[model samples]
Target chain A: MILTVTLNAALDVTYRVARLHQGASTRVLSVAERAGGKGINVSRVLHTLGVDTTVTGLVGGLTGRSLRQDLALAALPEALVTIGQESRRTVAVFDEAAGETSMLLEPGAQVTGDEWRAFTARYAGLLPSAKAVVLSGSLPPGVPVDAYASLLRLARGCGVPAVLDTEGEPLLAALPARPALIKPNADELVATTGLTDPLAAIEQLRARGARTVVASLGAEGLVAVTPEGRWRARPPHRVAGNPTGAGDAAVAALAVGLANGAPWQSVLARAVALSAASVAAPLAGSYDAVLYQRLRDQVAVGPFTQL
Target chain B: MILTVTLNAALDVTYRVARLHQGASTRVLSVAERAGGKGINVSRVLHTLGVDTTVTGLVGGLTGRSLRQDLALAALPEALVTIGQESRRTVAVFDEAAGETSMLLEPGAQVTGDEWRAFTARYAGLLPSAKAVVLSGSLPPGVPVDAYASLLRLARGCGVPAVLDTEGEPLLAALPARPALIKPNADELVATTGLTDPLAAIEQLRARGARTVVASLGAEGLVAVTPEGRWRARPPHRVAGNPTGAGDAAVAALAVGLANGAPWQSVLARAVALSAASVAAPLAGSYDAVLYQRLRDQVAVGPFTQL
Candidate 1:
């Protein structure tokens, strides 16, 4: 089973309103809450696809309890470590009329040194039974900057392939550990490598020690630089829907491929299909099954070439 | 001890951000959360003033748990009834740059018949030991429209004076139950009475069955019509700050007056002083102690006569 780690797990709250008026009171028509974070979203997509996965992370306080309950409700297996501070929450306000969304992300609670030690111990325990481990999302305050690097080292020691999905310093710090794969979206790729060109960014990431670099270009689709060769996979068509979790959906496909040792072409094709299907669906970690099936075969996977 | 009932209690979450950009992700600089509701605010004010008070309300789910934990941390006594559904949350985003606040109110969980029954049973159990009770805020969906009326009747049956602070249909329904005092702001008074004049609105409210009507006219202070006589109390000068919980502070003072059987002039003076002092404070359920003490004597109180 693939183990997913979301160090900065969140109770994602979505408010549906007719419209948002700044500096005024808006009565939310509806509220939808779920356990959310990059790794958790990846696990959700994997679980739905009938892939074996376990969600492991740090959670605490009342918000943490809600997140755990939601994970249970979703039937996602979890071995979350409890901490002292309350977990953070991300509020997304969706304007029905404007068809737009705004978000407020709380800076998550500081994980103390002791808590980090405890989490690593738990992660080590879980690694023994894991085929592959995916470390995703930002490091909460007080956590070491190279948190993923440490986790990558632990996974490597256990002979488990690791997939790292994060951006900025944490992403940069984790690269020297040589994770099996890394998935960075277009913006994240540019930010991480300081390169505007996707192929160049992927190359830079691979040189830094990532065995495989899969960069997702929002509407453009997946570009992968791997040991096998460089390849680009484009979706059959652009799907109109929320694109928030499309990249995570792609990560789920890549992790599944990593666990099964699938070829680069098939893996990129599956990732692009899943990413597009997720866009067709309204919520993150969810995909349109019919669209995914139809697009899986239609996804164009070809050799990558810089124009 | 005064009893404050908040059927629609909330975990008030405040996000302090440099600025809010619509349809974009804003990273909150800080987050502050507290248990809140109109009645809870009244209880908080009363508690802060060293008054003997108990907070009674309907709270449920994880949000409720957080609310209760906050109340406990504040050292406010409570006998909250639990329900199956989660309590609501009100998100207030304070834009430091613009120096303004915007809010998103979750349409609290629907109270089932069983939950309402459970709440009334709890209220009934608490009323026998209470000197006075204050019912405040809006009713959640599925709760009977005359919920406050029922509570008022129970308070009256237990020989406890109740100060009802609500608007629209619930306020109109509870008026016939003859609460000891009803505090309505200028807009609520006008809406309730369908009259443009504050004095006329106060008269109409008393005519309906409220023993007294204390109408808050914002910076203009308060105009109270009671059995003793009509009186007006104005603050020494306008103190600019947040006015969110100003009325609740007045209700706190009114509930104290109802418990002590204070004269109308003294009660109105105290209420107006506390209201203005609350306006000078940043958060709801809090007051500027120095300002409150200063304003207590400086407030101009006299027999009110309509021009």
Candidate 2:
């Protein structure tokens, strides 16, 4: 079973309104809430892909309770550490007429020193039984910036793939720990390495100690520089829809493939297909299966070339 | 203790962000949540005024749990009925840059038939201990349009002042039940009675069996045509601020006044002063104590005019 860690889990509340009239009250046409975080999104895709996965992170207060309840529907087992502060909530307001969404994301509650230590201990305890570990999302306040690096160390000690999906200081700090796979989107890659060239950035990341670097190029699809083989994958056609969860879908496919020891081309194909399918789907962590089945074989995978 | 019933209560979540940009993700700088509903707002104001108040209605699931925790901080005792559905959540996005707010209100979860009966039974049980009972806010789904009428009947049967604070059909249905006082804003009065003149609209309400009619006129304060006498009251000077909770402050003062059998002039003066004080404060259910004290004596409370 794969283990996913989402330190800043949220109760993702989405509201559909007739129109978004700024500075005025709008009667919501409908509201849908679910448990969400980068890791949870990956876990959702993994579960749908038929991989056994468990989610563990910090869960606290009533928001945490609601999140856990939301997760119950997904049938996820949690070994989450309880904290004194409540977990945060994320609001997405969808305007039906305009077909737009404005998101408000809370920074999340501060984690105490004890809570961070408790999470580390729990992470270590859960590491041994997992085929892979995926550390995702931003670090909450008071957490050491090197938190994911510590988790990567535990995963390495247990001899399984440790996937890191985060940005900024956390990504910079975790690189030296040499996580098995680090999926940084084009923007995150530029922000971290200060280089516009994705291939050059991947080499820089490897030199800094990441075992493998997979860069998500948005509509252009994915480029990877792994130890075994360098590859590039692309969808047959661009799907015009939300790109929010596309990266998480790719991460899920890659994590599942790494755990199962799939061929590099097959893993890249699956990730590209799933990412495109997720983009066509209406909400995050959801994909169009019929579209996935059709696109899975259509993704073009070839040897990577210098950009 | 004053008893306030919030049939359709909410967890009012307020987020402060730098600027609200449509169709983009915003990082919320701060978040504050509180128990909210028209009746609960009244209860909050009464509690702040050092009046003992008990808050009751329907509360369930994790949102309810969070609301109850928030109420605990206010030292409120609950006689709330249990329900299977989670309570509603209201999001208020405050744009610090533009100094404006956009509110998203969910219609609230559907209340089961059993939950309605259970709430009425619980509301009745608390009626005996309350000096006065306030039935406020809109009816949630699955509740009858005449819910407040039933609550007014219960309060009448118990011989306590039943204050009705709502609009539309709920207010229309409760008129014949003769709640001790019904507070409707000028627009609500116009909508319900179809009369343009406040005095004529109030007379139509009295004709329909209402005992007293207190119409809130926003910056003009309030006008009451009661059995004791008729009075119009306004603050010494208009306080320019948020008017969100001004009506609720008036309701709280009126609830206290009716319970104590205060003279008409005394009740009008208190409400006008508190309402203005509340408007001057940053949040609803909170008032400027110094403003309230000074305005209490300075408010002009006298006979109503034809204007």
Candidate 3:
């Protein structure tokens, strides 16, 4: 089973409007609520794909209770550590007329020292049962920048493969701990390695001790480097929709492939197909099973050499 | 006792920030939550002034639960009609640097037919005990625009004075019901009467069967036209602070004066003083007792000719 961690979880509230005008009152057509955080997204996608996954994170107060309730309604397995302060809420205003999206993110609840220690102990206890652990999303207030690195070390101590999918300082700090896989989008790769070229950034990531590096190039598809070989995979047809959780879907596919001992080339192709299918689906982190299977067969996987 | 009704109540969340920039993420320095709605604001100010007040409104789900809990925490007496859907939440972002406020209002939960019947029955049951009733705030979704007019008719049937504080079509519809008093800010007064001049607007409102019309002109104080007399009351000093709930504070003072048997002129002066004191307080609809007393003595009341 895959274990996912989200240090700063949030209750995401989405409002559908005909259009959004700044500094003007709007009447929403509909509203939806869900649990949100990178790891939660990854676990949700994996669960949709019939993969066994458990999500662990810090949650608190009423908002946190709402988050957990939503996850339960979705039938997603989760183990959230409770805290004193309420979890933050993220508002996504979707404008159907303009085909535009605006976001207002609340800074999540602050985590206390005792809460952090409790999460660490719980994660450690679950590491033995977990085949692979994925650490994702932002560090809440009061958490150190090196928190991810510490978690990476803990996973390694238990001989579990760790997949790290975060950006900025947390990603940079965890790279030296040699996680099995690190997936960074183009912009995040550039920010972390200070390299404009994606291939060069992948090389830099590998040099920093990541066993394997996957770079998602949005519409262009996936570029990955593994110990056995390097491969580039792309979908035969582009399926356009909201691309909100496509990357999380890709990470879920990759973890599923690695745990099943799939070859690097096949794993890269599966990840690309799953991601494209996610964009084609109406909801985030969800894909049509038939479309995913058909796209997986049509995905083009070829050898690639770093310049 | 004064009864305040908020058909579409909300949990008002305010975030204080150094500055606000469009299309950029902002971190709030401080956060505050309060039970809010036009009628709720009026009740809060009345309670602060040691007036006997009971708040009645529709509240539902978790957000509604939070609103009720907060009111109890504030030591305010309330009689809430519970509904099925959750109450709404309003976000107010305060940019201290620019001294500007931006608001994002949520369309509150839909009110069902049965819910409306229950609420009206509950409201009617409480009317005989109230000396005056206040109907304020916007109508929630699924509620008719003429809701306030219906409630006003109920108040008249009970022989209790009713104060209407609202805007747009709701206020326009309520005028024909001949409420005891209607307090409309300068903009709302102009909108309802289609007259730019304050005196003319008040005349239009009075002609529509309203027994009394009180027009609030922010820093200029208040103008009132009653059966007894027409008068203007001005604050002795300008207090620099938030003016968000000053109008509601003025309406609360007006209710208190009428309940205490104060003359029309004294009621107008007390309204101005209470509003100014609210401006000096940190929270909206809250007045410093000491400041209010001092300002009450200094309020200038005089006869004024219609412009």
* Models ranked on TM-score: 1, 2, 3
- Which of candidates 1 and 3 reaches a greater TM-score? 1
TM-scores of the candidates in the order shown: 0.98, 0.97, 0.92
lDDT of candidate 1 over A1-307, digit per residue (tens): 9999999999999999999989999999999999999999999999999999999989999889989999999999999999999999999999988888999999988899999999999999999999889999999999999999999999999999998999999999999999999999889988988999877888888889899988888889888888888888999788999898999999999999988998889989999999999999988999999999999999999995672
lDDT tens digits by residue: candidate 2, A181-288: 999999999999999888888899999988888899998989989999899999999998888899999999999988988998999999999999999998788788
Weakest lDDT window of 10 consecutive positions for candidate 1 chain B: B298-307
DockQ rank, highest first? 1, 2, 3
lDDT of 3 by residue, B1-307 (tens): 9999999999998877777544444566777788999899899998877788999989998788889999999899999999999899887777788776767778889999999999999999999999989888889988888898889999989988888899888888888889888899999988877888888888888898789888899988998888988788999878888788899999998887766668988899889988998888877768778988998888888878863
Q: Tell me the docking grade of candidate 2.
A: high
Q: Which model, 1 or 2, shows the larger TM-score?
A: 1
Candidate 2 clashes between residue pairs 3 or more apart in a chain or in different chains: none
Tell me the spans in candidate 1 whose CA falls farther than 4 Å from its real position: none
- Tell how far residue A109 is off in model 1, in angstroms: 1.7
Worst 10 residues of 2 chain B by lDDT: B298-307
Which clashing pairs does model 3 show?
A: none
Candidates 2 and 3 compared: the better one by TM-score is 2
